[model samples]
Target: MFERFTEEARRVVVGAGRESAELRHGHIGTEHLLLAILAETEDPAARVLIEAGLDRAAAREAVRRLLGEGDDARALAAIGVDLDAVREAVESVFGAGALDAPSKEEPRRRGWFRSEGRAGRSPFTARGKKVLELSLRESLRLKSGHIAVGHLLLGLLREGDGLGARVIADHGLDFAAVRRAVEVTTG
Candidate 1:
């Protein structure tokens, strides 16, 4: 399916991985895909996003914050671990902000998007994968031979339950509005 993705579309996919990695996230969620699409400033999808009031980096930050800024802390709490308490204990022993310091071990930054393997990488979530699949459907529906950025954005819009699509809706954009915007930009 990826064979039909245009170079720009492929970059968006890879960029989603990089975004997830950079954010220290364990999975490439649909939100990361939205960020990747927004990062592609030259793409029509991105331009449509800009017009819809969700331009690049600032919008990315908003999406992350909206998706629960302290997600890891909450996750730890769910497993009967108080992250803040643990952090306080560590800080009392090592001094304040001890965890903020970088480790001497510069961990190797391997990309998750590498095709050879997916193990131990930030794998895409089920919804994220679904968005990619939907992109193919979108391309076919539009009578396009290749999956482009617009198609990818359309996929995000179509998958309305995903956080990425929810974010778009939160920003006051419905799927139809987004589709029309994409069409205008592509034309």
Candidate 2:
């Protein structure tokens, strides 16, 4: 499948991995893919997104907040949810360090090896893989010889339930509008 990807399409896919790694995530999600697509300023998909008001920084921040990563505390702070205060309240109700109790679940392993035998690499989450598959489908549907950025964008939207698609929808970019833009750009 990768063999059919255009250079720019390949870069977008690779960039998704970098975005995931930068976010300290163990796997690439649909959100990471969206960020990567938005990062490719020269791509038609990216230009359309930009024209529709999706900035890379803001989208990345929004995805991070939505995923409840390190930014979770900051997002909570914005809503006046003092996590520290919550911890304190919990500790006051139950003894000290009550909120800090160790979990029984084993700690996840981290090293230069994984189940797929890729050294020190993360895998694509299920939804991410689905998006790629859909990209191929979109390419075939459009009678395109190679998978292009526009097809990838269509695939992301066609995936329907991916975080990337949801964020695009949240920004008021409906499927019809984006499809039209992509078609125009491709032409």
Candidate 3:
């Protein structure tokens, strides 16, 4: 699944894992992915959420509540999350093969390894990564070829108990609204 994603998407997954760990959480689920998406503020998907009036701070608070942790830095340190394990798990979830050398003589595809000077590293912050992972898993469950912005929107819905979801709901946004927007725009 990671292989099928663009470099940006892969970064989202990685970022999500790190953020999940910071939150003292053990799983790289959809909630983390949604947060990851938000963390990457400049990304189109993030822009969409922001435009939809999703409050990042509020969402974070909700996540804290969902995790049953108080709003303190100590809460983050309580969990011993394995970053590398999270990355590996993200790769595994996406069906990515080992990160080894490609077959000899295989022609490198255009745009492969080309960052387009956007950034040497991913723009996805740790929180954004969490959201992205959640979205990616959901997209896979729906058998999508690649993770789309729409998937991210839907992932926010799946995190119903989280802060982000509540904010979205308060804004009168839901999976159906997001899906309609995506369909109208993409179609």
Q: lDDT scores for all predictions?
A: 0.78, 0.78, 0.56
Model 3 agreement with the true structure over 13-131: per-residue lDDT tens digits: 66665556556554454556666667766666566666787646655666766664323444444686544466478778765534322434534445322222232222333344445
**Which 10 consecutive positions of candidate 2 have the poorest summed lDDT?**
111-120
Which segments of model 3 are wrong by more than 4 Å? 70-145, 155-167, 170-172, 183-187
* Deviation from native of the Cα of residue 164 in model 2, angstroms: 0.6
RMSD of 2: 9.9
Better of 1 and 3 by lDDT: 1
What does candidate 1's lDDT look like per residue over 1-187, in tens digits? 8889999999999888767755656788888899899989899778988877887666676666776434676677689997657878999999975765343444455543342234334778889988999999988988888999988888888887888887777777777978898966553
For model 2, the stretches where C-alpha displacement exceeds 4 angstroms are: 70-117
Residues 1-187, model 2: lDDT tens digits: 8888999888888888777756656788789888988988988778998888897887887887678544656688799997768867888999775754254454467631232434334688788888899989988887887898888888888887988888888777777888788867753
